[model samples]
Target: MEPLEEIDIFIFDTLTDILFDKVPGYKEVVDMGENSFFSDRSTYLFMNEFAVYLGGQIIADRTSSFVESSFD
Candidate 1:
């Protein structure tokens, strides 16, 4: 298996933080993916959700609310 890149680690850590705060049994869910090579449906769904959330976070982080307000 390939090692996770730096960005992958960042996303995983961010997702872990978010999931640990918001979801029950997140460790089990993550373990399912890690153990199964992500063949499980639950793991797949969680990864998809994490990716979407991370994408949104990245966009939000890069954008300035002040800049947005200037256009109004």
Candidate 2:
């Protein structure tokens, strides 16, 4: 397994925050290895979802800036 990059850590941390908000005591479960919530498959899915969401946000921001600049 490769080491996590800064972005990977950020995304996982964001997901952890989201999980913690939705599920009480989720952080405790995640810390426990036996029945970890951040399993391989779950991590993969969360990473993919974060990437897509981030990408779209970036594109939208860039587009809005471009349009604003063009009008200025």
Whole-structure CA lDDT of model 1: 0.49
Screening candidate 2 with a backbone cut-off below 3 angstroms (N, C-alpha, C), the clashing residue pairs are none
**Which residue runs of candidate 2 sit more than 4 Å off their true CA positions?**
1-4, 36-42, 45-72
Listed per candidate, the RMSD to the true structure in angstroms reads 11.1, 12.2
* Residue 33 local lDDT, model 1: 60
| TM-scores, one per candidate | 0.33, 0.38
lDDT of 2: 0.51
lDDT of every predicted structure (CA atoms): 0.49, 0.51
Ten-residue stretch with the least lDDT total in model 2: 63-72
The local lDDT score (0 to 100) that residue 18 gets in candidate 1 is 64
Q: How large an RMSD does model 1 have?
A: 11.1
Query: What is the Å distance of residue 56 in model 2 from its true position?
Result: 33
